[model samples]
Target chain A: MKLYEHEALGSIFKKYKIPVPRYVFSAEMNDAVRQFVDKEPGVVIKSMVLVGKRGKAGAVKVVSDKSQVEKVFSDLATREVYGERSIGALVEEKLDIEKEFYLSVTYSTKDRAPAIIFSEHGGMDVEEIDPKLIHTYIVSDVRSVYPYQIRQFLAGIGFSDKELLRPLSEVIVNVYNAFWGSESRLLEINPLVVARSGDKRKIVAADAVVILDDDASVNPAVVYGARSAQGRPLTQREQDAILIDQGDHRGKAGSYVELDGDIAMMTFGGGGSTVTAETAIEAGLRIANLTDIGGNPPAEKMYRISRIILSKPGLKGVLVCGGTASNTRIDVTLGEGLAKALDDMNAEGKLDKNLVWVVRRSGPEYVKGLKMLHECFVRNGIRGEIYDSQLPITEAPIRLKELLIKLVGYKPEEVV
Target chain B: MKGTVYLNDKTGIVVIGATGREASQVIKESETLYPGIIKAGITPGKGGSSELPVPVFDTLKEAVSDPKVGKLLNTALIYVPPVSVLDAVMECLDNGIKVLYIITEHVPIRDSEVIYQEKVRRGAIIVGGTSLGCFVPSVGRIGAIGGKDPTVAFRDGGIVVISKSGGLTVTTAEMFKRRGWGTYMALAIGGDIISNTTYADVLQEIKGDPRVKGVVMLGEPGGSYEEQVAGLIMSGGFDKPVAAFISGRFQERMPEGVAFGHAGAIVERGMGKATDKIARLEAAGKKYPVKVAFYYHDLVKTIESLGVPRDFEDSTTEHVKPLYSTF
Candidate 1:
């Protein structure tokens, strides 16, 4: 997951003995900047938010005077950056920059290995930098990043001076070590400053962004204290989904994301879910939320997921689709869990009277499951259509869209 | 024959973490469906006890030391937790397991990298870390892939099926079953960001098997595995007709960096788009003459049009013999 703020990454860099700018994290607009401003000529104020491109969002500001620091701090602290409210503000001692450099490490799917990218131009968008100035090196193994490779890359990027290359290469090695140690998927140091103050020149990381892998097995509690997808706190629905999956070991029914759409879509399997979502969208159905109910989840978990999907506002219909089940019993996920959930919603008047439901599933006991779903929908006085595994999974969305246009009185263009 | 991978009657099997909940359930089901396949079990501390007729050992070393296990074991079905998957894999490799089917999910990428490197060094084939495993009809099912009832969707035939999604593996098999076609073998390589095996790896094996007259590949948007398959096809790796379906085309409309479903199912920096995969595969198909299926049902039509060998003209009248006669 992405690190929430610069402070989190700074702490990690410090642990690796990498030099970073002195900084202090604060929630209040009070004297946080006073200490940093007195130590350095200027202080950089940054909003502590999970979202990126803070500089472009005006969430970052540099001020030399203490009087200006409070205004800039309040401006960033009060505003929301990329839909996420700032938890606090970071005040760091600004560095005396003689030269700026960019360094990052990430897995390259093309190479199927860890790759490092270094650029002499930093403190700006690396994408806009000249392609000739960027040097990329892909490591064949994850065990170690050789120093000679770093020297080679630096030299390729026109770092011919030995004195400059020596310190820069050392910083790169430390950053690589930190990335490897934390099992991070992404580690970026933008504007790795070459500070020339008085008669001393030192290389230091001015800004850092680190995203650790979600797998807790590598280093438990290395990044976030708890397992989380987004850097920020989990939404209520997300927490409920996690609880439901953890409550039992029978099957997996987690990873729920609420989307801005009118159709409540519950899909089975990871790849299956994406394909279902894409198909639904293609057929002119906007998905209200995405739910994965696979690995043969029990009826209880399925009911909870279904209920949550229906509870979302502006839902015009519900679509439950998945790849043909192998080990997952269709009777449990669809017949008992999903149908039961719809019945409850109908009873509670939570479901719209005109809402249409469509389900396409296949596997062992699919006939019985389909029959049970048909009976439940009929008993609940719900308008619905059901297709067994005989139909290709890709047809679920197109079929559902057609049904919605016909039964719900939706226009052809509206239902598309 | 040297690079080909296949599961047959002679392939012995062992289950790691055999005493675990999911593993135990799968073992019991497999035992009922196909006996005499699972030869041994491995649980770190739950050795000496038996998970039914299959004997248990504390370690891979201990399990392989037994003359009965040493003589028969060739494949390992791993069901260990994510934390211990790397160690379990190393142990299996150290003990001479040639083929590994890791059913565990959420394995750390770092550990996966190490496992992958070691696998290459040892020249072993690994199926998955988050996979449902493979099924060779009339031979045996290595993992809980074809569900509680394998015969419902699978049979011995001329088609070899490979998919990244576990659910689709059975679904594709069902499609073939509906069309009076049967699968020679079906495998799910897992939908994780990094799978031990890819469509190309399985396709290479299918090329060597004369029984596999055609191939069906179910790929999704995310990694370049689909592109790799296209590359192989362009290189003329197989002589049989190949019908490919790449899902998640709508992800291109969604926001970048937002994963639609699987960990690997994300489009970033304009890479791993369903559109790109489709375009590349279609372009390659022109040169290689592969059939590209946009809609899922189209796969069946593509395969049928190619006229792969089949047993029955109509699925309604034919009653194929079940792998397990007792069932």
Candidate 2:
């Protein structure tokens, strides 16, 4: 649910009346960029990405000459920042920096309240900043935080200049307003600069890092459009997987993220799925995708996700794993739901016979569930292993690897 | 709030979204565990209809005002949609329902914040946004935790099990069952960033409860709940020995902000790391009988190392047999 810089500045920040330097973002240089360049005295070209510290990644550049604008935009847009391809390039008016400060609005788990974090020293990443220097103000009210309140805190934190205090406090309030108005889980403005606007000094948000609440009642996807958690475009399988739980709270069978490995995983429960995926990776089983399925989803709910999991191309292995369930009926989720999916795929000749499969699940009616799944494996001649809770949850990966090594000549860098 | 979560003669229950599939299913399963606790159901405009085996009321107010239902009901289980949670919670608070167990996940953070403010202002006990349920063996259960018959995994002994995830809560209990032990209480506090009911809150409420001897906590890699629990154990309220398991340790190697399974399980700004949280627990362990386990499966052995006394009982109930008859 993270928003790109352009997305935030164009809509949310402006809606909150936070001063943002005029900017234009595009995949390629266009007339808008040329007009924007003609108006601003100085321009900063930044790579539009979800990850922070784009400056450190050499994705940001200063265009001193107008002739270099298109080349810089192309360079920033084409480059990958921290392993993710740049979505586009953002061109903004570079401010004449008088000073910089740090500000953000996010939830503080310790206080169970919305916290506005402020620091006089900016431009440094949050981790590098001295924890003591950062002042935290817990706001019980999510509706608003008044400017005078921030003004008092700013003066207490050594803001002696009365002229700068009011405007800066208003800016801070606007930032909080943006965060609260947009229902953002996190909105950080690093290096919020006190810039010289002709003869007057103005406060402006130099950079924005926004991660919207995905679970918000407002459906962030409607505003931000649909996206994968990894800041990439959604694959067809991922799109289908997300639609499984839309407006349906029966049980969550959705939460799917595509990875670059060869194993298609149908893991259940949040904690169970994470533990299984970590073990699978440690055991050197490349995961093609990851999913967290649980909460006693109906048989049909499981049927759809199961089909999506098995429909992925180039998957050499399939791992169905989870901890012992509390209430999720294995007979429904697996015995009936997944069994039917496998039958359908097999009938359509979409099922891959050469792929190795391993399942380690236990819970209510798991015996019937595993028995039904085993019949599918038998009928399709799929080679793999199936285990219940007798096998250690962490050991499911090693068991899959063992079967893979024996049956498919899978090799691990280290001796097992 | 001492026995509010536990089902007893004084406990009165109402299902907010009783007509919903999940809510009705929980009502059915919970009735088998303990009937009469769930006195009524509330789904607007469904009044005078008997769908979930309980009398349906149009609103929480109407249900709370009934002579047969209102006088006894003190707790509510909410299963409404994410957007309607704020209103549902407010109604519960206004109606004097002391205990609320919310089974809905994906509740907006702002809504959770408002709920927290009001819950504090009113001094009401609230649990979960994505919580599985609360359980007290031989007493009753709330939400869909511990399955239809929790006795299959849970038996009243002397232990208290607290976990961030419902699956891990049951897994911990089942593991203890293998070694012939059970829990006095096992509940999921939910893994949302803003947890209305946290480990510390539960520990505070359960302070000096005689049925609880020790506690085994299953933690994840996000939120400061585990750290707060460590602080509470170090303080005077939690005198009993505790064992903790913080899962997702490998997240230390991944990118900082990558989302783990839980919404609150992401590591941001070098905070909420499993190693850091474990370090805090280990620090508290020096002053308290806190045992830390790194791996998920290592929790049982870690808790057993505490050497606390257990009220040994024949945990072998008839429930476990039929469920595992396939084996």
Candidate 3:
């Protein structure tokens, strides 16, 4: 099962009956730091972004006095540690602890049933601990988790007394309830801290990681701050693309991606793009973008996607490669678009001698398109190379690599 | 001499509804790669004018009669809707263009089966009843509506890709791109159970190819094909390392065997459990050892682990070159 980071999963646990320490999320580190210093001098300042092992990543910090709070918050929030967008830090009150415990409930892929795992010893890497100490019970039915079932499972983990067992069992039951309700792939509570005897102690979850099954479509708001399984906030572009793909809005075929590379590669088939990218990479060339030219679409739609790929500032080249399998033809739009771009570049005097334009067009209408492309380049005197071959995809990269090395002086031997 | 060839004496790609925009795309892509592309001379009453540059006659015979026309690429990429795919694929196959790559989708499965059997008799390569069609990178791509993107998609790498799902093949490619481990070739033959070609065919192709150093197979729950392929590897012929990750583990948690997306995703007693496939492969590894390879065991270490004996481990970066090095 995949693991979810603190803010996303911890938020879920604090919603269900699981006892977790009080916490607050804020966009401003200054405000969060001020609140922590004023309310509790000793508190944990954690980066609220989605990432694992923040404690090790130095995203997590602990401050004892009021003065250190600002320094810790700024340090944790300023740097971009993982790929997640900076959302500031989560400040929370430190739970008073005497001892720690471990517990988890998850659906077993092998057994085809829900399983509960519990341990008296917790916190320090639950996975590294003895698998035997983490007592496990597979339950096919949810209703089977009665008071006695919880006792049986807890007793297996060395809890014999009813007094300590009663409240712990209730916590275990509610946890499973929340887990099942959330349809979580995994619910891990590392070091469910148990309070000391005779002082009114409570078991609080020290850490939580919950991987929710997206297919369940259980609203994230219901569970509180649970991000999608991808473990990152949905970029507007990505969300928009998903929406368009699922609906009939676009009606045209296209795939898009925003990357650091300059060249925007929008090819016909999935197979062709893979080969082209691999070839470019192997040749010590970089692909600034990747996209699919999708099946039959109106010319307008095709132009729109081509424009998007070309819109990238660094995009210096475009590769239009497709396979020839029986029927189908490479459209003139592929040629027309490249020609249009070249005309723009020439008019703007932006066309570089080193700029590479390669097109491997196949299928029925290929002859006309290839001829059209050749005429356009020749008439314009724009530099490029085109190959009409019956070779497998593996050979295309070699050709591209050879052209790049010969024309651009790129080292062909270096592995990308 | 043993290199894979996209076109052969028996392979001649045909375009149905040759005048339509969809058919035009098929004609353009196919003919550009394969020079001797013979379009199916069919356009109902308007057979007088050539569809694009290709000769068009009133009947399939007139199309095949061209001296340049070799064996018919029987499988037609029907640009027409569901109503026309049945007649189109049937006519092409009946006239002996056995290998049909139907680009059109949503055609009733029953109609697909009828054409499927007829093509089987003729020994035609009927790729899609409902398919994204297929692509062979630089060599040639068939039924690919998207012109050039696929040329770059199936770039040169060592992973032999076999997928039951069509779009999932795209996801697999993305993974390869992310890991910087390109692929030798990936065949997404579509999810039709009576698929035109089986994983066995693709695996056999990979086994015979010297360039494929490793095989990365993507299998979902259902069908005994995974078992069949696993058994084929057990015969010790597949010298390349096989690395795979089986999805549909979530499906096993369901009540019983239920068909998922692919026709082959059925969980019978001996079929379609991700763990079971893993177990079978593990067991096969014990007996045959060299034939079965797993992908999860570190991408770097996979070559050494996949039955390529220790003495022969090519430690140099020379063997580590991209799969398309020879290309």
- Which of the numbered candidates is closest to the native, going by highest TM-score? 2
What would the per-residue lDDT of candidate 3 be over residues B1-327, giving only the tens digit for each residue? 322332333445666767666666556655665655555546766566854666655666666665655344444555655557778876776676655666554444334444555665576666654465554443455555224445433554566566654544544443443344554555666544345566666667557666666666656555445666677877765645666655555345433423334334445433457667767766766655333223221332453456433322222222222211111
Write the number of the candidate with greater DockQ, choosing between 1 and 3: 1
Put down candidate 1 lDDT per residue, B182-221, tens digits, no spaces: 8888888887666789888888866766677788888888
Sorted on lDDT, best first, the list reads 2, 1, 3
* Per-candidate DockQ vs. reference: 0.37, 0.47, 0.04
> For every candidate, what is the interface RMSD in angstroms?
7.9, 4.5, 13.2
**Model 3 over residues A155-256: C-alpha lDDT tens digits?**
765775557788888888878866776656457777788765357877777677775543233334334532322345533433333333332322233345
Model 1, clash count? Answer: 1
Candidate number that wins on TM-score, 1 or 3: 1
Instruction: Provide the overall lDDT of each model, using Cα atoms, as 2-decimal numbers.
Output: 0.77, 0.82, 0.55
User: Candidate 1 has what TM-score?
Assistant: 0.90
Model 1, residue A179: displacement in angstroms? 2.0
Top candidate (lDDT)? 2
Q: What ranking emerges by TM-score with the best candidate at the front? A: 2, 1, 3
State the weakest 10-residue window (summed lDDT) of model 2 chain A.
Answer: A407-416
Judged by TM-score relative to the true structure, which candidate is superior, 1 or 2? 2
Candidate 2, pairs of clashing residues? none
TM-scores of chain A, one for each prediction: 0.90, 0.92, 0.67
